[model samples]
Target: MTAISETSAQMALRDPDVRVMLRVRADEPGAFAELVGQYQHRLVAVMHHLIGDATEAEDLAQEAFLRVYRARKKYRPRSKFSTWLFTIANNLARNSLRSRQRKPVTPFVSSESGSMGPHEQMVKDNRSGPMQKVQRKELADLIQEALAALNERQRVAVVLNKFEDMNYAEIAEVMGLTTKGVKSLLSRARMNLRAALAGYVYMDGAPAPEEESERPV
Candidate 1:
């Protein structure tokens, strides 16, 4: 009887799709497509939050896949297959942001009228209310502004933590940071979000009450 190795790569092999990715590495038929089918939506979602444009997010997600395909020969899974995949995503999103900074635009225009963008998705997922009464797109715009107030690194970390539901250690692996560094980054990001959204409607879509003293002025 042979003992199993519990290393990340070995553990990752347990995921059927990761095994497909391994076959992709070996140039097997349809394996790459299988891997892409599994992660395309997720990758695009993360890219949308990071870059704030749906069209661009789709492009970047495709680019990430291309890069992964190209790097297949060198693929060595030191972490979960998704972790490795997102590390590639993280780099592409940051690069896109930096490129965008060279030529500033007004803002991202939603590619469609009715579909929810990344910020709206976050707001709806993180908070709940009788949203039918409010303009969802406008509320999403407000949240997007709050997200914009954070610097690039904070924004990226926040998206990964919140939207991706990744823990600090996992985020560290993705972002190439220590666990403590991730903690500090997320802490500052949350504080900035609070300050930015203060006195506005809360995430749950309720009005924020004003604080006042009974003594009066």
Candidate 2:
């Protein structure tokens, strides 16, 4: 079990939930560690996005997985395993944010590629556009600045939606927010980011409102 055969790993991943989890409860060697390796970075990045301090993010993430490991016996597989796993993450992040004397935030930077800060997938989504090179540098700087300026809840919503590609339910679970609440958070995040990056994205002689209104319409 130290090294799972590819076929075995694929089969395990495809198997029903209870089986894979039961494998974990039984300590079937790689079962537990595999789970850890698969989830660790994403979980940490989610926490880091919410709490903004990498040290605190790491601590909360450790607590989250430890909570998961401790709960293995009681873990009934009612949903996607990631959903349940992130429930623990959600709670831990909320608790950490509430208990802190000061809210924490991660400084955004472009060169560092550990999970793209926020809206990072935008780069890939628009990868081949004519403005790719210019957009990359502009977007990189804008994302870095915009992320730092967001409120915590908005920040988390943006990360989960824009970067994590999590659906509303998953984001709701992660933020301890209602789905509608998550929607509102995301809307505000978008508005704020649009405003923050307006100069970067829309400045370069793109339009003059009076000129366009007079000419086209």
Candidate 3:
């Protein structure tokens, strides 16, 4: 994104969160805490779902907020606060994947220790029974395997499009690519997702029974 004029920046920053950002820009005491209160959970959720690593997701979410704090003085609200927020998150996720290449692929499931850590146990307990938990774990494993199959750029594009609800233009801006390039990336991503979720009813874009009444305009 290019720099904006001061007047335009001020105008755009009129968003309520941007006002809180202005406090951060001014280096107000405890402003960072306020910002964290506002965005931390959201950033963590975005990172976790995008990268599929809960531990690293927390780390990356912290780094994204730190970036926001460090750059606060120069912060211009040309985009929605969320767009800028996720742009930082997406960049960190890419870097994390690069570092991960040095290590082996590890599914989030626990090994033969026959024990789950606190987090794993909590999620496992929510599933219906032993059979359902195992099925859910298997499905999760398959999804991760499919995500691993994507090239980095395509993966980022898919995450932004599917999870973040970013349109082509915002995704292109975040990934630093052209609109046409983003279109191509999403096309490839859809193909990969189709392959990954072949039997899933979601691929057909049908809303589930509970959600049909809440359809968007």
Candidate 4:
């Protein structure tokens, strides 16, 4: 076996999810369902952020899982199971986006039982006041707009980084880019997001009061 495949085999042995997937590949009972239960929410959320339509996202997520099951016989652990799964998702999402001629749709954020989605969580204030809730909603809208402003590749890179908590190397593997390329892609994405959300959000730290005063109304 090649060195890279050998390393991946080691990783497969260590990753519990990979083991579960291997079981599915072997037609073990309930393994496929377990895999879906483990990753369905995460995959749907990622697809939602990528494509911006909740229904379409669900469809895409289901398709991704279907593809995984269909490809089970050929499955080989070249990386973490999540990485392999998301690589499929990323490709599907990209294709869907490309097929549409219109601008990207605004992402829909769903809340359940007063819980916040990732964008809301990021910009939500600690205060429980009504105004704070309004402001949080506004910030969430702006953040979603900012994300939509990024190109498909940049959006994917940022989503995987922020939402998936994947490091540069893992993201590189999923996106078929070199590590350096992923870094550069994220750098540009951050710059674009910061520009899009300039007055409302700070990329590094909170702006000084004086600087805040200078922000456009």
The most accurate candidate by TM-score is: 4
The lDDT per prediction is: 0.79, 0.70, 0.74, 0.83
The runs of at least 3 residues in candidate 1 whose Cα sits more than 4 Å from the true structure, single-residue gaps closed, are: 1-6, 109-134, 201-217
What clash count goes with each model? 0, 2, 0, 0
Runs off by more than 4 Å, candidate 3: 1-11, 107-137, 202-217
Task: Report each candidate's C-alpha RMSD, comma-separated, in the order given.
Answer: 7.0, 9.9, 8.1, 7.1
* Candidate that would win on lDDT: 4
**TM-scores of all predicted structures:** 0.78, 0.66, 0.71, 0.80
lDDT (Cα, 0-100) at 150 in candidate 2? 84
Q: In model 3, what is the error at residue 159, expressed in angstroms?
A: 1.7
Which pairs in model 3 have colliding backbones?
A: none
lDDT of 2 at 5: 55
Q: Indicate the residue-level lDDT of 154 in model 4.
A: 95
lDDT of each residue in 139-182, candidate 1, tens digit only: 56656767866898898899888988889988998999999999
- Sequence-dependent TM-score of model 1: 0.78
- Which ten contiguous residues of candidate 1 have the minimum total lDDT? 207-216
**Per-residue lDDT of candidate 3, residues 1-217 (tens digit):** 3345666566567767777877888889987798799888778877876677788899999999999988998887776677788899998998888788788876544353245443354345435343334455555655655665678898788777877788998899898999999999889887977655554434244664557868775
The parts of candidate 2 lying over 4 Å away from their true place are: 1-19, 102-142, 203-217
Backbone clash total for model 2 is: 2
* Ten residues in sequence with the least summed lDDT for candidate 4: 125-134
